[model samples]
Target: MSAIDVRALSSVPVEPWRNGGGVTQTLATHGTEWRVSVAQVERDGPYSRFDSIARVSFLLRGKGVTLRHRASVIRLAPLTAVEYDGGTEWDATLVDGPVTALNIMTAAGRYRTTVNPIVVATIVPPGCAAIVIALDSACRYSEPDIGTDGSIQPGQFMIVISVDRPLRVEPAHHGAAPPLIVTIEPVPARTPDSNF
Candidate 1:
């Protein structure tokens, strides 16, 4: 089991010519089965349609963006994630300023994820996975069994632990800042017939 420090995430520019929006990739199929990317939406952009992918977008900074899908419009707020079919028509409108968000996309039938806040002393059950992000500048995490202990500053995110193991979360230390946790689950495997 390994712990991924969110602060260490590398930033890659989002090429609109390629995916219809500006984005920064943290992790993807290159290192893991799922793709994790972050984007900063500055203005109205083209609607994105990914026929074979599933995505969850979490608002990180600013007032957030207005997500338009077909005839539906959803207002996403900081600390909340909106899950939708990647193949559907989707667009965004920045509310007050440039909106920052964490986007997780996985090829269909590959993986799924859950994003939420973790209060201290919470024992994340086995088979449950999570990504923890520090919403402030002084948040810390500790796991006794895994020998994992660290802190996350404001604007930093960590991919806590993979789906292969169980996890536990402790509340932030006194004066510890707020944070967000996201859990991911990989799709089951498909076995091929040897006779083929």
Candidate 2:
């Protein structure tokens, strides 16, 4: 995998949900097993279900959303990532209004996903495959290997392949918030003979 895979916000096409509750822009997907996308919750309603999948979601914008899963009420704020079982029954209540979120879902026992907030301008996590999403403002990112540079605006993101190279992320201007980077690494796949 290359050190950088850039996906512009304008290039990502919007796909509506079957229930018409909201829309999503898919960034990357590995067949039906795993996917990374940005979703907008336009209404306060029940969330879609994906059995046997695990999801890690980060609140990118808007006021907030509280997800009710099983007996837990999880409040998601900006730049915070929350993991939940996709098979669980969950509903979302918008605190202020509509919200935008970065979602990463993986097949159970096949892959593990982590979404972390990037608070400073520095090198990304060492040796980890990840995606960096610009949350508040435009971000200028440069890769040393490819000798390439690009920018992703708010609501835009890019994929970083399995290259442990350093990347410099700079906000378009001062006082702009740092980006939220989501790292999706493959875990040991579970087979019939593999024990937990």
Number of the top-ranking candidate, with lDDT as the measure? 2
Write model 2 residue lDDT over 64-146, tens digit each, in one string: 89889778887888777788888887898998899988888888777767776555565654555668887576777776665
Q: Return the top candidate by TM-score.
A: 2
lDDT of 1 by residue, 1-196 (tens): 5545556443434444354456555543325446666666766775467788787888877787887877888777887888877787777788878777887877677766777665555555556456766555445656657677676666566665554444555555546445667667766677785442
Give model 2's TM-score versus the native structure.
0.79
* Runs in model 1 lying further than 4 Å from the true structure: 1-6, 9-21, 27-32, 146-148, 153-155, 160-165, 174-177, 187-196
* Residue 148 in model 2: lDDT: 68
Per-residue lDDT of 78 in model 2? 78
- Reference-based lDDT, residue 32, model 2: 85
Q: How many clashes show up per model?
A: 10, 0
